[model samples]
Every structure is written in C-alpha cells, then in structure tokens.
Target: MEHSTPYKIFLLWLLLSSLMLSGVFIVWDIGILRAILQQDITRISTIILFVFFGACVHCAWRSFYLARQALMLAYLQDELVKEGSAVQLLSLFPRGSCLAQEYLVGLYQGRDAQDKVLLSEIMAESLRGTHQVGWFIAGIVIKLGLLGTVVGFVLMLSSVSGLDKLDITDIKQLMQQMTQGMGVAMNTTLVGLISSMALGVQYLLLDRCADRLVVDGVNLGQAFMSVSFDERSGTL
Candidate 1:
C-alpha cells in the first residue's frame, strides 16, 4: 500500500540505520570477513551478529507500521468525539447498550473492519520482532563473553605451566596476553548489555503505543457499526 509522507520517511530512517550499523560491524572486523567461510569462532560470531542485525531490521519495519496506524487511529477518534452524536455511535454496535454507545461516542473516529484487522496484525508483528531482537542480542553477548573467558583461562594456564623457568620478560608478555583476553571477554558482555537494554526500552514503548492503537481501533469500529445501522433505520 502507498504510505503517507511521514510513514515513508520513517521507513527510510529504519533502512538507513540498519545499513549503517551493518556496515560498521563489517568494517570493524574486516579480517574476520575475509575469512568468513572458515569454520571458526570468527565465522560463527559473524553469522550470529548478522542474525541479530536482521532481527533489528524486522523490528524497525514493524515499528514504522505501528506508528503509522497509531497516528491514523488518533486522528479518526478526535473527529468522531468532536461531532457529539451518541446515536451515531450506538448504531455501530450489534445490540447497542448505554455503555457501548457511550464508548462509541467517546471514540475519535470509526474504522472499517479491514482496517481494524490490519492494525491488529501490525501490532502483533511489532511485538514479536521487538522481543526476538532483544533475546538475540542478549544471546550474542553472553556467548561472546563466555568465549572470551575461555580464551583468557587457557592463556593464563599456559603461562603458569612455564612459570618455573620463565624470565621477567616472558612472564610480563604472558600476563599482558591474559589481560587482553579478559578485556575482550568484558567488551562482549558490555556490548550485549547495552544493545539489549536500549532495544528493550524501545520494545516496551512501542508495545504500549500499539496497545492504545488497538483499543482506539475497536472503539472506532463500534461507533461506525452503530452509525451504519442508524442510517438504514432512518433514525438520524
């Protein structure tokens, strides 16, 4: 479907951000990319990283649609409430009650059944992607951290094996290697925690927005249904 200008802009932003982040990851590990086909840690990490990146892309797409739906619902609701037609709202329901009619009247605008279904689907997809991205990022970080810890331990143990005959120079070099390994391990954990936290917050905010949109859609539908029936009955 043709999107509004704002929706188009939002999609563009999502695409650009995904591409830029992917580029950064590739450039940062050019050497790893050169040997990406190799069956090693580098290759495995690259695969996992790309999967997480894909999840982010999916989340972005979902967010764009959800935001658009929410905006549309808000506008429609405002228009309906401004008209102040209680009967119009009541006709939207099957067997209109005071509660249903009031609910409909309070809505901003009514939407067709198809539009309501579409909005619901968009919200569901967004929630799925947001949660998936969070878990993927967290998994990547924990795996990298563990790998680093293992490497560090191996280096430290190897150094200890030669400690009895090692000169100060050798000891210093081994200690340095061990320290670097530990740093690598910690860096992975840090990356994972930061990414997960940022995305988690975004997910929650989007989910809340999506929920509101669904409620608004339902209200709108009820109002529209009542109005449609009222017109047929000549009760306007």
Candidate 2:
C-alpha cells in the first residue's frame, strides 16, 4: 500500500479548515462579525463558538498524529514481511516509537491468535479515546446556543417590566432594548448551528481515519506476524 493513503484524511482536514478560515475572514471583512460582538452584550455565545473552534483544531491535530502512527505501522509491516523474522521487526522499530509495537511483540512472545485479536481492540479504543472530549464539546456547543436564545428572550421581555404607562421616550427605549435582544438571539443560534455542523464533519473524518489505521494494522499482523491458535477449539 502507498504510505500516503493513511494521510489523505489529514490533508482533507487541512483543506477544509482553510476554507473555514477564509469564510471567517470574509465575514469579518463585511463587518457582520463586529456587529454580532456588539449585539451580544454578555459575549458568552461568542466565547462558546471560539471554544468549539479550538476543540476542532485540537482534534484535527490528534487525527494527524494517529495518521503518522499508521504510516509507521505500514512501514514496519513491510519490513517484517520482507525479513520474515520477529527479531528483525523489533530492530526496525525505534524504542517506544511505534504505536502497535507492543502488540507485535506480544504475538512473538507466544501470545495466541485470540489474544492478538483482543489486543487489537484495546489498541483501537486507546486511539479513539483521544477524541472523546472533542465529541463532547460538539454537543455542548449546540446546547449553549439554545441557552443563549433563551437568555435573549429574557432580555427582550425584561424591557417592559417596570413601565405601567408608555410615553414616546419610554416606547423608543423599549424598542431599542428589544432589537438588541433579538439580535443576540439570532446571532447566537446562527453561530451555534454552524459551529456544531462544521465540527461534526471534521470529527467524522477523523473517526474513519482511525478505523482504517486499526484495520490496516490488524491485517498486516495477521499476514506476517506469528500467532498460535488452539487446535481443539470448535466452531459455533
């Protein structure tokens, strides 16, 4: 397999993130971003959106890191197949460098095929655990946006509490307050939905990349590495 196959998802992430950045610049250039900031008096919604963006970046980096590990695994698999020796495979890997080296070592140390299968699952989980926070933050982003909408409606309603009579001046003040509240509601909802969806796409890609890495590594191990199976075991 080409070494570059594992990194394709990461490259796509970079391209998509670049497009998002471009969109941000365009929004800023048009002054809409500035207007949203001014309208959101508490700035809470804006902060949430920024936090979501940071999470996306962090997850993307993690995915890229895993991709590199996959590439390393592929290289080691090629070497192991060529040399046909467990000792040679160990020599090819630097100390504590390869992601699945332990599993390979385990198989060579007399671990059975069943044990290898279990270890593969554990390794897959370990890699997947890194992205848990990113997924969680994605869900929180949407809820926070809805919270902002509620807060905005509260602000809009609060404008009429103390006034028993409506004078021209009081009515104008009320309208101004309502307008600000409405802006906050609309801005936050828009930001929240967009951020959540964008984050979702990135994470979905990362998930698929991780899965591919696990599958490729497992397949290589089954093909070239030594594994023992129980001859007495019966099929279901």
Candidate 3:
C-alpha cells in the first residue's frame, strides 16, 4: 500500500546537474573562462560545451517524463487491485501511457498464445527506443572531442612543415604556432572528456530510472495478471 514517490530520480538529476552548471558558472566568473573559450581556435571545445548543455536539457525533460510514467504505473496498480478487472485499464490512463496500456492490451488480445516472454520483449524494445538517442549523443560528443585533438595536432605539425632556412624569426613564428596548436589539442580534449563524463552520468541516471520502470511494470503484470488466456479473458 505504501508506494515510493516517483520524483526522487528526477530531483536527484536536478541537484547533480545544478551542481555541475553552478561550478561552470563559478569558474566562468573568475575570468579564466574567456581564455579557456578563446584557446580553441577551431571552436571545437565551444561546440562540445553547447552540445553538452543541449543534452542536459534533454535529460531533464526525459527524467520528468519517465517519472510521470512511473506515477501512472502506480495509479494503475492501485486501480487494478481494487476493481480486479483490466477491462477499463486502457481508458483509465492517457494515450501517452503506452507502457501501461500496451502491456494490458497485449495481454487481453494475446489470449491464444498468452506468451509473457514474447510480450516482455515487445515492451522492452519499445522502452529502449525512447532513450536510444541519448546514448548516441553521448558517444558523438566524445568523438567530436577526439576529432578536435586530431585537428589540433595537424595544425601544430603543419606550422613547421615549410621550415628551411632556420631563421630566428621563422623559428619564433613556428614556436608560437605550435603553442596555439597545443592549446587547441589540450583544451578540446579537456572539454570533450568533461562533457562526455557529465553527459554520461546524466544518461546513467536515466537508465537507472528506466530499469526501475521495467522491473516495476513486469512485477505489476505478474502480480495482477494471469498468463492463462481463459482466466485473463473474463477479467478483461
């Protein structure tokens, strides 16, 4: 009867994300931020930062979305326990309550086969699709950082490629160019790594919530539903 609150995961994400953003702003205010931003001549580091912020926004939205679904699932469980019939379950939830409704409907319509295993597979596949984009974005951000590293190295090496006379002026220019190249490589790599790790953590939280949702959903099916077609037919 005592159900856990669904907002815990969402709230935790907000806290962790806020801390990270706060740290960035604190550093930004200290004046080193400009230098950091300016170091990446190719702007790869800046791009990575922007992309990371976008992913954070997405994770926040998704956390809220998943929490809402968890709440709906809880409500469905309460109603099912009381009414003892799944016939009205679909009507009870919103159209977006795909996980709950689909599971129940699948059970109702799958009377002939009544295969819980197959049904579970279908439900999991649906859930995975919802968060797959987040994973892809996580990976792309890291790759972009690596690309910046390569770009920086290329710039560094290209500066000395035309050296022939070994003049002091030429050497000075080459050294400056190499420093800029090193700056690009180091700054971008740092930005990319930090962004990837931060984004990865947010997605990790999302995955935990998702896993909980699946477990709770499966338990719900087992607790209130029967695999026997005849038994389920009358209830529906």
TM-score of each: 0.53, 0.87, 0.87
Put down candidate 2 lDDT per residue, 153-190, tens digits, no spaces: 88988887877877877898999999888888888887
Compared with the true structure, the alpha-carbon lDDT of candidate 1 equals 0.53
lDDT of 3 at 36: 72
Q: What is the lDDT of residue 133 in candidate 2?
A: 79
Per residue, candidate 1 scores C-alpha lDDT tens digits across 1-106 of 2224555434554655666578657855885434323323323344445655665675677677675554454544554668635444435434322222333443
Candidate 3: list runs displaced more than 4 Å: 1-3, 112-114, 227-236
- Please give the lDDT score at residue 185 for candidate 2: 85
What's the true lDDT of residue 52 in model 1? 52
Clashing pairs in 1: 76-108, 76-109, 77-108, 77-109, 78-108, 91-225, 91-226, 92-225, 92-226, 92-227
- Higher-TM-score candidate of 1 and 3: 3
- Local accuracy of candidate 3 as per-residue lDDT tens digits, 90-195: 6776665668667776766665444776777777666555577878888888898899889999999998888885687678889999999988888888888888
Ordered list by lDDT, greatest first: 3, 2, 1
* For every candidate, C-alpha RMSD to the true structure in Å: 8.9, 4.4, 2.8
Model 3, C-alpha of 101: deviation from truth (Å): 2.4
